[model samples]
Target: MNTLKRTLALVATLAMTATAFASCGDEKKESTPKEEPTTTATPEDTTAPEETTAEPDNGDEIDASVKTGGDTFTIAAWNHDDVPYLIAQWKGLSFDTVVEDLADNKVDGIKFIDMNVGGGQAAEKYDQLFNEGSDLDVYFCEADWALKYINDDSKTLALSKLGLGDSKFTNIYNYTDEIGKDQNGVRKGISWQAAAGGFAYRADLAEEYLGVKSPDEMDAKIGNWENFVAAAKEVSEKSSGGVALADTLGGLWQAFACGRTQPWVVDNKLVIDDFCKNFADTAKELWDCGGVTKNSQWTDEWTAAGVSGNCMGYFVSTWGFGGFFLDAAGGENGAQYGKWAVCQGPTPFYWGGTWIVVNPETDNGEEARDFIISATSDEAQMSAYAKAKPEYVNNSQVMDDLIAGDTVFNPTVSGNFKDGQNYFKKLAENAKSIDFKGLITPYDSTIKGNFADAVKENYLDGNKSWDETVEAFKDKVAESVPDLEWDD
Candidate 1:
């Protein structure tokens, strides 16, 4: 038989066998923590909810042998490598290894392509590829757009279809599994990193302004929105109005939106829940106190806030800590390099994550499956991941051991950063508190952007009242999702 034809037959056989194991009890969903402030679920709600590993024997556990006879396969994602620490730490023994092993002809004739969908164009390209059915064999689905893909089985296939036992994931974090699964508890994707977030603050500024720079003391000060505002007032008073409490207005919204009590669209109706309304109030108060500037996120000004000491800090997740935000915080040797600390500021909110998914349309499912398992589930690879880099990995057991200092991933004190404090402890605590089980919607990207714009224009800059701002918001959301229904 031809190689392509044989590949299809094998994948079909594997899918059938995987479905036979579908009844595994470990598929039981984790109950969303009732006390979580980020989301209040009603069963049908879809909530929108990182990591590295090196390979010692990952190939052994997952049988990471490359399938030689399949058609050339393509995987699309936002960057060259979303998580560099993992790739760097692995030193060529991971998904990278699998691809290398195959590309080097150690295997057979499989063609692997890493489609670098530029950061700004990823969502557009992903949607385009699905619409055109352009051989999207493997792809990464981000948290904001995950629900859309999960619900569309045309694009995603359930992992249980591989007949892999839940035993493979006993150590996985409940939230990771929860997000990857559809409403029926069948997982279609998986992540290797836990992108838990906290307030990344200038420890020096905390002491200079709040009179205490340590996380514990600072945590007490900006523990909640009210306390945060009070601290902002202190900043305005002390910095002679030179520094704002937060880096930008966008930072405040980033933290606030995660604390939302319900999805933007609940039950086919556009409802503004308590959390949404509270943002208006909180933003207004911040404006009054000079707590936040109008700078947008990802802009030069916003990035400069962390470095210039013009603002106290940023609300960034573990990914930000490992790359983006940390890089923005003046790299490892920048001025203020060692003056940073993180804490659970006011809520348990996840900023970002990338889920590994397979395109059901591919003739390479078997190979795709092995890649997913190697990157996300292989124990040896995950274990080596911790020692190579300091990431809040997704495996609960792995994270627990890492938290207890099981790996060589050490927090450096050379520069006296946070006084050599281990920030992973706080990261683990914050990661566990997340419970956005049914509060996700695919349109979050649109709604979140519109809402932020509405607030910035009407309330912050134009002097519109909260009610007027809500009216503007409704007009905007209605335009974006014309089919959506909202209550008066």
Candidate 2:
């Protein structure tokens, strides 16, 4: 057989095996947690009503690779959104036990510090914890700012210390694995979900405005940036500038910025190439032509856009279908429900994702190792969590099986899409192709935010030229990150 056929056969075999394993347990689905809020102290609905006593079946024999018997396992995160649920899956405890008891810090052998802050502010809280020499074992990190801890040897411990070698995580998506590693390629962190993204457009709007009948046609219409811009213009003209093809400038940046082929900073020098100019030009055109919405992201106006039919599409990731996306559809029985479809947009990109990392001072190495295994490596546990949490889990093999087997993750969310399409399938295609091996930098979060702000204020809003916008971006970034060198 040829190489391609062999590869396909292997994947098919793995899918079948994974499906059998995934069927081993009864899946009890729960409502996904709301997206982390910037100002909220705690996550909404941190406590769940149901009790789950059954532990995930990890086959007959257990692999106790690391030493056990630590007195307490302490986990920390910015909010109660994911850590509580993840720990519940790992400890076989009720979600309520993890959330409520952990909030009071009364769980006998576990301590979960919610921090009660946003993801961006969590770094400072973590630094304070380290300063006080608090008892911290495992912690979560966001993708953009993960390098802050991963690069600090005193903050993060290598997974190898817990016997979690690359062999154990072979089935995980490559881009996630890349983010978990540090500057020297040492494996410092790992994520449980593959947060791959695609363009979810209103099928009714596409039909009315673009004359596209299906997602395939829609994707072909906006397959690349140039084509996407043209399609947006078409939508604007057809709608008489009443509707926008893209959601917001921030959303566009989320999908557009990921296509960069060079590191933002190399050898302590900032790099600004034609990619910056192209994005500015694109944003400016869309801003002027009403091809993209002017609403700032994370506002009520953004969600209202979809409900009011003012926007045609959203660049959404796997996690979004539950929270903001559902709100955008005005809930399950809302006016716009069941009118959406997803396609691998102009480019493959990922939005927000969380990573699990161990503290170098962890006294509970065994619990940390076991938790990571259950959350990330053990196919049985991950499959169960994926179904229960309804997440696009990191393991490619498990997701492949779930998608292949036509497992419906969530009925209500699926009902939000046209014909209840299997949305994970489209996200899976993008997940496999995201290449970010040498692209991550510790200053990524600050730099990306600064650039976007500069573009919005200086180029898109103020109508500045490319060079002037570049200078404004430089000045803004210099205030935040003064160490990097740049041309005047």
Candidate 3:
């Protein structure tokens, strides 16, 4: 097929596949108050105007008309599972500290509103809160959700206007330039945590079976995809096909497919470039080498394989490493504790992290901004980190502290937590943000469905040739993002 025709065919295939699995539903809601436009200013200066009124001494005494009660700052977030680290800390602290701290500071209340939404429901809930002008103070959303909210002009409050502009978050901007700026060079969102992507392995197994003594040596053996494959083969051979490198396909695909040039789509066109193909091919090869497990269920497969000590390692996000794997290793339900380690993979990729945004319609816009700044400040960030180390963003000092003080060991590598942190930090330095405009088209849900099916067909179904898989991806993209175009 000619290149243009080939590309078009691929897009069509992906589009059809994506739509098949797309969820059809809207998010539910809890009632609140109406919102009024606080103030407006030029994009150049986003902070709100200073208040002439003296700060209230009693958090409860603040003007109810403006602030949402000193005791009541609602946090809109997805499922309780999304922020495990935060949940752990909050639960461990008995939930009183969050309230008492706010009250003691003369702040009224704090409420964590769980918006049990997932997949497409998440997107819908986000719109309801921001687009529809619902009354919410703080929004906790993933990168994809954050991208959509920030682009919608009416929904979000610009951080710069809250006096957090350039000065307060300089360190965040410097660490990852992508999060600090929007498409228009405007600062829209701030990362609350950094999702450093890497490989988590069974260190005890490596040492026992493969004679791998340390993380540095193991990392050297599987430094990149090519090396990783070789190491996987060694592990498989050593273990007599008892332990594979990964249990699922999605994690590995994400690790290598994400690129710096652009998102999965560009200008309404699907982008099925070398990156995607390479990732698919790598996965295919690993499957062939008996380096991957065959279970399709994520949590179940992860639990069974992890606890059984049946896999060499798996690709995971930084937070995932801390929350999921850590629990698997140490918790009562955990079976792999003290047997794992972490290492950076071939490419730098981020899976999940949240951003906190303000509503422009809130009456206490200035106060809201200050609150955001304080919450994300170095002091607060460090405190949050101390309580829950989920690879958070903001304040380089806090990140440094977490990395330096971490002692958790990864099962994949033969070293302690510090070694894994260094590897993850290095990968984070090269990580890039997802460009919402480029990747998420009107048919985003459809595209995701098609892509998921295509992956299943190519990987699970009878062996498909590389060319055939590429052709399928191209067709899928064309169908899902018909208006999308690729720049020559």
lDDT of each: 0.63, 0.77, 0.52
Whole-model lDDT, candidate 3?
0.52
**Cα RMSD of predicted structure 1:** 11.3
Among all windows of 10 consecutive residues in model 2, the one with the lowest summed lDDT is 16-25
Evaluation by TM-score, superior candidate among 1 and 2: 2
Q: Which residue pairs in candidate 2 collide?
A: none
Cα-lDDT of candidate 1? 0.63
Candidate 2 local distance difference test against the native:
0.77
- Which candidate comes out best when scored by lDDT? 2
Error of 2 at 474 (Å): 0.8
Question: Which residue ranges in model 3 land beyond 4 Å of their true spot?
Answer: 1-74, 79-112, 130-133, 173-180, 259-262, 327-330, 380-385, 388-393, 405-453, 478-488
lDDT of 3 by residue, 232-346 (tens): 7887888888888775665665554443233444434455545445556666777877787775535666657777777667677655655565544544334555556665555
Model 1, residue 402: distance off in Å is: 1.7
Q: How does model 2 score by TM-score? A: 0.85
Candidate 2 on 237-309: residue-level lDDT in tens? 9899999999989888887777766567665555676667778888888899999999977899998999999
Q: Write down the TM-score of every candidate.
A: 0.78, 0.85, 0.71
True-vs-predicted CA distance for residue 20, candidate 3, Å: 21
Q: What local lDDT score does residue 241 receive in model 3, on the 0 to 100 scale?
A: 88
